[model samples]
Target chain A: MDRKLKEAIASKLMLLATVFSSLLIFAVVIGLIQKSRPILATHSLSELLLSSSWFPLRGEFGFYPFIIGTIWVTVLAMLFSLPLCLLTSIYLAEYAPAKIRAFIKPLIDLLAGIPSVVYGLWGILIVVPLIKDYVAPFFGYSATGYCLLAGGIVLAIMVFPIIIAVSEEVFRAVPHEIREVSLALGATKWQTVKHVALRAALPGVIAAIVLGFSRAFGETMAVMMVVGNVARVPSSVFEPAYPLTALIANNYGEMMSVPLYDSALLLSALILLLVILFFSIAARIVLLRIERRVM
Target chain B: MDRRKIEEDFFKGLMILSTAIIVGILFAIVAVVVLKGAPALSLSMLTQTPKGGYYLGKGGGILNAIIGSLYLAFGATALSLIIALPVAFYLREYASERFANFVRLSLDILWGVPSIVYGAFGFIIMLYFGLRACLLGGIIALTLLILPIMTRAMDEVMRMVAFELREASYGLGSTKLEVVSKVISRQTLPGMLTAVLLAFGRGIGDAASILFTAGYTDYIPHSLFDPVASLPLAVFFQLGTPFPEVQERAYASAVVLLVIILLTSVSSRLLTKRWSRFVIK
Candidate 1:
């Protein structure tokens, strides 16, 4: 009887796990349906997203600028961050002494755990003032640096750890024998790193950089704080801009215009979701091909 | 050779310089926050209620907020573990066939779904079920939020306990439950704790979800039904007005949040280090 009871309990537990997994998929399906429901009403969903004016309250809802803004800030952030992160990762992975690497690594990891709100606080108090007073006007730009320039700069800082940590993992994964052979052939440390180590880890590094791009693309809190939350094409690199994540965060609270507002917000979210899924899948496919070739 | 040497030196210098810049951003953020947050720090500000003014001490103690954040996070973590641990153990120890693999892949997609979107889902659905603006609602929301992580981490840990170990325990007449409770959980205690700590940290930092459900208040929570203040809410609510004093408290609270994160990270590092050493034998 005890053995039978045990088996019954075990089976029940497994069923519950199955149910929880099903529930999560159910959630994604609901969110997708909410987003895609607008297709029933509109012939041209592209225009809904592509129109520049986003007056959802007046019923002319266009999420174009927000999408553009998100892409702009993210592209700018990647432009600023990628090269810097690559060089830094190479330094830590190839050049840093054991003691220093151990010491500095956690500090970077600590940055990962620090809440987005704290970064927002820093952006407001320090970044905004510096921008308002100095940066924007200096470049014959708007009255603030709380634009693409400031937001991208801060985002690069925020995502720097991810780039370094992931790229370092990839760099470490490169077979030592390849580096060994290169060194034995009298290739210098830099040459072996440049030609062999980095080459071997290039796909993984691409994965890391792409993930960083997606993060910058989807970031909300700090960008909301530093970008002055303006919805205009940047007058200059120093001029303020809005992004899709910031739009969702900033506007979700007071959007009471029924289906129109909900439809617009959900559509943008769906687009952002698609963007993330695309990059993630692309990275996996690319890495799989690379891994096969290496094997 | 000379040109190559020059190029190498320049590249190395740039790498070191950029890394310094990255580290500098961390320092600069901390310094700026402390500079703004310090003058506002006082006994009453730490412990009093808000009045007016854009600068100096003006608000109530952040004590309630701190306490609320702690209880909610703890409650949420407990809920997540309760829901996730049994499920994980069942999945790993008993389940068979392609269905299990399919379920696992779905869990991965759930992991990628944004936290804000989850918040949106919870706000609408949880409210419909009468779980509205209460700590219980917040706790439930956070449980769902952290469940995927807890289960995935725990599942991996349980599976890493070798078949031979379980066999040896069975040879000594231990049942499956005994093997799980005594052997697996004990062996994987550090990994389990790390996962819990990570979930706790995420819960503490979370704001978007709570902004919709766990409505903010200044008063201390007298019952689970009472709406409560948390660090994230404190920061979010203060952003509306132009009061410098309230805003500065937001910075101090931000500092406190960072401290909580730092402490959790440090503790987890220590725990994992000790566990790896324990496993080396």
Candidate 2:
């Protein structure tokens, strides 16, 4: 009887633990909503989201510029990283010998493991200066070394490992028989990889890119350091811009002094949470489909 | 060259070039931090807290941040393990497939949620409780941040636990709890350790989630409620200064943080390998 009672208590405790773990997401969403209720109650959704002005001191809370900034930086990062990652992953998957693959794989993992602040330091020291001295002057822009371009480049480098790792897995998932069939049909090795392996892995590769994009969208510290925290719509890649993550990171502490400033920041956090959650869910679904198909 | 041959060679060359660029970038990051950060890394910097005007390149060290980071990461990892292990066990032993998938999807979403969002959430919770930014708050925030990661990793490890071992335990008339504790735990000991270490590395290296909730201080924290300094925040604040020397100090701090992460990662790899010998593959 005592042993049965002990088993019952253990089972109950484990169930409770699972319930608590699963409720964390709902709790975060609720906490964000409750905190931002003050602002959400006062401002219309369209005005809050659509207007470009974000002067918090004057009580203007339009996040349109930040939205545009986030979109631009994320798109630029994707543009820069996707091609490189695709090519590298293809090489690692198809061309490299086992020894080379073994050697390079861990290096990429280490790259992924480096913290964002370290990436920020590298960006401030290296990429920003390079862009400022050469790329900006060539484009006839004054070089402050902190601009959307710098942010995009830093973020691209930061997310490169993720894309490479994911895409490499996707490429490897393409059955060897697929490549063999293509090669036997008189296709070159490159042709087999491009036409057969890549096509077979298209869905997984797209999922990988989406996951990479989500990571870039939500990246805070490194992007915040390089992207000149100016709250304006950027007209050019060289122009300074403020992303949503940067806005939240830079201003959340001081905004408590203002009446509605905290609310506005909290609301932005809500929007960020919602956006990332949507993309993450979509990516998970796509990945799940791939896993099921492979099984 | 023939058209097809030229196309193939050109694309292959592009792949090689891209791979080289990626490798080059990684080396450059490590080189810049070590080269620039070495001069500033002194025994004083590692053993003492910042003195007056440390941000202005004056005397002092980042010992406070170093100790504070270890405290926070260790505390948070311990707290997460209590909840994560049980959840992992529940998912593997009790839950149905649909429910397990739902739990995994939720954890995946949580894992992808930005660290900044966790900061905001923690800050809001702090405000509601009328508590200030302190080590406790930071611990709580980081616990939330790493919980999903720990649980998922442990779940993966537990799933790898073979079924025949559990059957043998049951054949001995053992209960579900007994089988899990005796059979499953031994099998997954290495993976659990690796999961905990990975979460620790992640928690220690993160800056955004603790930025608001931790509330940096120059002194070491005396209690859980006292605000504390951390290495990532040290790097952030020092780098923000206009003085060149302080910026160099910031790089030193980055190097410190990098070394910590590298040690955790490499040790975790080694530990995983070492412990895998005992695991029933």
Candidate 3:
């Protein structure tokens, strides 16, 4: 094709892609503009947010149980993933010899590339049975190993790669001069890392962790597979529970066309979007705040 | 120094332990998926449909779903590349700061929008405009899901083409289009292709948007307006099954999806690895 023809064709292609997504966004904008009328709740939105009852089949759609379940699992997953991902990132970024770092980084890369479903199958086969027989029963439970512990434990494993990759990048982004500055101050290598390079990258580290949180919260398949999909507020960490993402992924296929059911699903999705958006914005804000402090 | 040695030893132990565990999980997951899925792979499984394409049934392989995923993803990627590049070029290369920021934030929010919400949005559009869970709906929805990544990637490629080189072209009395299209865009063709492939990777790996929007199909898609299935949806629907054989197939399908994503990401990263040269006069 002539240059004009090529440019014209390329422009047309770009037009098509933009228009495709434009249509979807237009649909979402319209839906937002046409909000359903608000229903009066005797309980406040806070109560609705905090209550743990999830009896959707019993004409009750309080999603507190699912939210709490999601929160506990997500929190625990982070608690486990954060330290490990940080330590690994530090090893890759600072401590490891060049050849060793090069050798090991691809493994982390491969871990990042694997899809969530693979982890779900592993959890079901390995983690669930182990939890059921060895851990849950020891804490006084039946043979059902699928519980918050199993789900949370596996979720930690799933997010480790993301945290390491992002945090490693952030750690590398710390200025060379900062390390020189720390060394000039007579600090040891570990002291420079702990007091200077890591401190410099703290905002980005926080951002990566928050992003990991959102990823864990948004994850559906693996958690849905292993969480056992129980709706009651988890009485303990060993009990089974549902997460918001898993709830939508599991129930949407067989929702039986109930109006409330559809609305409730939308509500949960909206809440998830808001929660992720909230964390994203919060991370940006935190970074901005850190920048201002440095300024 | 003694305490430091102990601390180093402790941290080293922690690092090796954690890294080994992470690597072990990845290997274990792959092995387990194969162990579960290998027996379910058969010739008929490749050629036949699953129990009328419902996850509740046991007999049908993902023949149609596999074909459907390819068609919808191919269509979506093609559509997205056609549309997203200029918008990205316009915003990143040509637009003012405020406009670019607005577009960037819009796409950032778009990327953050839940897949189910996107499906819900697609449903509203489909119902309102007489579109259904056919290839068109799925393509459009997947296009939306993929656009942010494409635009972002393409913009990065354009930005890396060097401002001084573009300025030199413009200083030679060339029009802005000549500088942008003939000079910058040409220099970054490989990068742009990587961008397109990356978007395709994300588009093909999705399950939730297709779950409601693409609907399901047990036959080859003969028209762009027909309901279709994709690999992620096939894996998803199959994983929900109670049948052991079908569940195994789901793992195999997931492994396939993971492999595709893995190749895409690694290839994109490899393609974009670059070095910069500076001149002094």
Candidate 4:
């Protein structure tokens, strides 16, 4: 082919690829909705989402317990990870010596690199037994190792790298000149961070936290292994519960033969996709706005 | 005055303490995985497939899962690259800034879509096509899972290729394709390699997306249509069984996975260092 024709064809191919990727999210959503039409046809959307009954074999597919369980674990994980991540990010961005910061950077990468399944194995081996033998007992509750609390703890560790990485960037993005001004005004280093850096980075930090929340919310295998897989609303941290991701992961194999069972699971996945997509988009928007303002 | 001093010291200590705790947990996870897994790691575990009654703690190894994981991840990464590279190039070279930004935003959202969603989506497509859970289906699912990640990573590096080089190429009567293929691709090759390795690591270790789309089997797959097992599912299945011996093998699988990831990350770092010298600043 001539160079011009070659160029035109290559450009068209590239544009086609771009269009394909751009439309993939829609394809996923539409495909899910189509697959899940059977369950939706039988039950109202609200009924699927709100009712707590979950007899998959008998055609009941209330996702309330799984939704609530996801909320419980995600919120609890945020509660555990946020303060530590914030503090650690603050230290890394502002206080840690350069060498320590360098050392911790790769450490965070390694933490993030460790597969979720390995994290799940770690949870089962260490966090679960610790919760069962020590933490729960100390709190005056006898418990199995697998529960909402174990899921939360494992998820907290899982989300630590994301939160810390993002928040550290946000904190660092607060200009050094601003901190100098605070110091010039006779503020302590802590006071400078409290009044200047943290205040300036609050939106970005919130965005980071939301990103972490979305990640924790969608996490599957790790949470599934530790969270007891019980289908119910967990009233306490020590109680077993099934999050939506776990519900789908645990049931996908067996659900195929049963009528509408796979559809229900797909609907649950749809819910997961929709929820995570919303949060992720929102967080990305916030982070983008922050980046624009900083620039 | 005393209160201010105390507050500063207290908050500073808290920050340091939190950092220490986070670091401690990283070490703890590795230590536990290594401690529990090393004893179970053996040549047979790497060389042999699970025998009959393997889940019953009979004589067997996870060679099936090991080979299966390699096939799936490698296939997925290659498939993702074919699409991801072109899309990334178009974003960086041909598209207008506003369009590029919009696509980047979409890619970011897709990146966060849970792996399970991809699995379900893949399964749905399989159902429509009268396909089974197999190696091809798994690759399709994982390609979707990693496509955004690879594209974004490549796009980030391409964006770093100085504007001056592109302009210079244009001055020499180079078409957009020539500038992209000859100038940009050569410069960003290392970053592209690293991104490939990164996606491969992710694809190899992920269990969720492939859980439904790639049905597990004890035997190593001989064809793309065959069901394939993976290391993550190996660990998950073994741990679910009541046998202690089987559970121990789960830890061994984890060790293998962890080592692969670590090697991927380390080699990427080394590869970047080695190749980056040829890259212009």
1 or 2, greater by lDDT: 2
Model 3: per-residue lDDT, tens digit, A17-77? 4444445444565573343112113335665577676555654567788898889889989
List, residue by residue over B28-94, the lDDT tens digit for candidate 4. Answer: 9999999999999999999999998888988879999999999999999999999999999999989
True contacts kept of each: 0.35, 0.71, 0.32, 0.77
Report the lDDT tens digits of candidate 4 across residue range A1-295.
4878889999999999998999998899999988889999999989888999998778888999999999999999999999999999999999999999999989998898888999999999999999999999999998998999999999999999999998999899888999999999999999999999998998889888887887899999999999999988887899999999998898887887899998899998999998988887777778778768866
TM-score of each: 0.89, 0.97, 0.88, 0.97
What 10-residue stretch in candidate 3 chain B is worst by lDDT?
A: B272-281
Q: Each model's C-alpha lDDT?
A: 0.73, 0.91, 0.74, 0.92
Q: Which candidate number would show the highest DockQ if scored against the true structure?
A: 4
Candidate 4 or 1, higher DockQ:
4
Clashing pairs in 2: none
Error of 1 at B21 (Å): 1.6
Which model is ahead, 2 or 4, in terms of TM-score? 4
How does model 3 score on DockQ? 0.36
DockQ in order: 0.46, 0.75, 0.36, 0.81
Which runs of model 4 end up more than 4 angstroms from their true locations? A285-295
lDDT of 1 at B136: 73
* Clashing pairs in model 3, backbone N/Cα/C closer than 3 A: A13-B82, A13-B83, A14-B82, A14-B83, A17-B83, A18-B83, B49-B60, B50-B60, B51-B60, B69-B230
**What's the distance in Å from true for residue B121, model 3?**
2.6
lDDT of 2 by residue, B124-175 (tens): 9899898899999999999999999999999998988778888888999988
Q: What is the TM-score of chain B alone in each candidate?
A: 0.85, 0.96, 0.86, 0.98
